[model samples]
Target: MKNELLQIGPVTIYGYGLMIALGILAAYMVVVHRAKSRRIDPSHISSLTIWSVLFGFIAAKLLYWITQWNNIIEDPRLLLELSGGFVVYGGIIGGILAGYVYCKKKNLNFLQSLDLFVPSIALAQGFGRIGCLLAGCCYGEETNHWLGITFHESHYAPNGVKLMPTQIFESVFSFALFFLLLYIAKRKKPDGFVASLYLLFYSLGRFVIEFYRGDIIRGSVGLFSTSQLIAVLVFLATCAILISRWIKSNRVSHT
Candidate 1:
């Protein structure tokens, strides 16, 4: 739950910011390696990566502001604080849209690009969860379980007690998903299959994990968590996409 990693000559480096930088670097490396394998000009990926990350951050902040509209209205300055509160789903939506547009303009296949990007996104998210753990945000409800973690002096912690450590749980799950996607990629499944599977699995993981979150929660219709609402929508959308692809594949097989 330590925010400040070190101080040097009156300058303080925040753990959260460091973790984000590391995540971006790790994602970039994966993207470059993937581009090389596909024989796509790596420079195109480099350019698209910049746009994706820039838009992703803006979308993440915007979505967080929307979620915490009351707080932002009370203190506009809070919007500038990058320490926490960013939403990963918003970032993914924004980044994917930006990347798709860029790929279309360059005459690249959108599904192939998405297949290359999704695993890296999962890896980055896994790293970002570590940041959440260190920054003491996105924590879990108190528990007597052996996996409990305590963030005693952090802003995200309501009570000075041990909690379920949901951040680490998500991180481990995402890391496993990352490897699974990489493995599935080698199998040469349908172009968009890996990305669709990524969305399905990630949304399922998020839906389950949101139940254990101890932070302030927003409700949608009928006792549903805000994230749960979004997850359900995304899950349905993913199912539609998978079904459409299956139908197309079947038609081609019959042809």
Candidate 2:
């Protein structure tokens, strides 16, 4: 896990930032391609992506800050650090809200927009997790089993220990999810179905994956970590939305 990809005197390129940048590029490409297929204007897609990503970063940092409030209060400088530590859940929440606002302002159908973008989100997540692997942030519990991967140089992960490659597992799952959702979309499914499925599937996967994660940065309460609790809530919310949609569809069909 090499955090510094390149350095020239005072300038240095970070692995996490580079991966995030690549993820954004990949997401933008997929979004624009899907938008064209759906007859959505490419310019609008660009604007939406730019705004969503900007707000996503802001929201992610804010949520991370909230989680580490005690540390911030003690040092006051941790808040200003430009290093790693941005919660994915926070970014998702912020991106949704930001997308909602943009869609409303542009008079676009929000759910449909979300459907078009959901698969790309999964693809981007897969790449982002790869970034986590490179930066050695979201590590997994130490294991002596054959599946365990060692990160000897990672500052965040324990050196010279066999740790579960949870980041790689998550990356693979996200990529698989992207394909699944993309197939669902090609079937011409309901507007919000893909987005709802993404929430349900990703939340459930993240909850299970959290068990293997060794990162101590994530806060926990009782029997679940912060991400696990959020995952449960997201799954429940998605279920409620799906139920409501089914009820509405039945009523409309009856009429």
Highest TM-score against the true fold, candidate: 2
Assess each prediction's global lDDT (C-alpha) against the native.
Answer: 0.86, 0.89
For model 2, how does the per-residue alpha-carbon lDDT over 1-255 read when each residue is reduced to its tens digit? 788899989999988788888988998998888888789988889888988888988888888888788878999988778566788999998988999999999999999999988898899899999988988889999998899988877879988899999999999999999999989999978789899999999999999999999986777868998889999999998999899989999999999
Which pairs of residues clash in candidate 2, taking residues 3 or more apart in a chain or in different chains? Answer: none
What RMSD, rounded to one decimal, does every model reach?
Answer: 1.7, 1.3
TM-score of each: 0.94, 0.96
- lDDT of model 1 at residue 23? 87
Q: Give the TM-score of candidate 1.
A: 0.94
- Please, what are the lDDT tens digits per residue for candidate 1 over residues 231-255? 8999999999889878988999999
41 in model 1: Cα distance from truth in Å? 0.4
Backbone clashes under 3 angstroms, per model: 0, 0
By lDDT, who's the top model here?
2
